[model samples]
Target: AQSVTQPDIHITVSEGASLELRCNYSYGATPYLFWYVQSPGQGLQLLLKYFSGDTLVQGIKGFEAEFKRSQSSFNLRKPSVHWSDAAEYFCAVGARDILTGGGNKLTFGTGTQLKVEL
Candidate 1:
């Protein structure tokens, strides 16, 4: 089974400052990593993903994530955060569908709420 952990429950950052959200994963085999953001009413939006190739992958909204196999972590980062960037961020690990051998399954972390101050 694969799982993900987001240590911080809430984080506050001033506008224009850099931000990093921690995400640690647990899996037996090589894992696919992803970061998704959910606003108050909207569904989750994919921030970034790392399945293979580069360890660092860029996503929408100026967000990027680096997959560290040694550390068993895939942390999300943004160079400069905007007020609109404040939301609930979820870290997820993708798993293969073993039973049917089709599709993919994702296990997400609890989430971290980001609060931005003007």
Candidate 2:
């Protein structure tokens, strides 16, 4: 069984400030990791993913994450955040489950609500 846990339920950041969001997961094997951001009344958009290659993966919208196998963590970071970046962020993991129909199923964390101020 695989599961994801995001420590912070909500976060606030000033415009142009650095940001970091923590994520932890539990899985038998190294699963496919992903980070997604969702705006109000919108679907999730992929930020980045960790499959097999690099430990650190860069994402769209000036975001990046590092996969730490030992710590079972994948934390998202941005050098500077914009006000438009205020939204809900979710950390997800792709794992094979009998309930899923062949395609990868994403197990998402509770979600981290981001609030960016001017």
Candidate 3:
């Protein structure tokens, strides 16, 4: 079975400070990875993805991540985080050969809640 694990249940960061979130996965083959951010009472927005190719991928809102196969990790990083970035972040793994209505399904982590202080 494929699964994703986010070590941090919650994180607090001051406005304009750097941030990093940890993610780990378990899969038989190379798995598709993604990070998403969800604000209060809102749908999730894609942060980044690592399907293949480059080990390092850049995302919107000054966010980026590096895929390390050996470590089974894909960690998200941002040099300066805004108060708007304070939300629930999720790490997800795309199911391979497992499609739901022709599109890949996402299994998300428990989530990491971020609290920002002004």
Residue 109's C-alpha lDDT in candidate 3?
A: 87
lDDT of 3 at 76: 95
Write down the lDDT of every candidate, Cα atoms only.
Answer: 0.93, 0.93, 0.91
> 79-118 in candidate 1: lDDT tens per residue?
9999999899999998867898644988999999999999
Ranking by lDDT: 2, 1, 3
lDDT of 2 by residue, 3-113 (tens): 999999999999999999999999888788999999999999999988878899999999999999999999999999999999999999997556763446789999999
**Cα miss at 44, model 1 (Å)?**
0.9
lDDT of 2: 0.93
Clashing pairs in 1: none
Candidate 3, clashing residue pairs?
none
RMSD of each: 1.4, 2.2, 1.9
- Per-residue lDDT, model 3, residue 98, is 53
Error of 2 at 89 (Å): 0.2
Candidate 1: lDDT of 64? 91
Candidate 3 segments exceeding 4 Å error: 98-102
The residue-by-residue lDDT of candidate 3 on 1-118, one tens digit each, is 7789999999999989999999999888888999999999999999998989999999998999999999999999999889889999999988665544333778888999988888
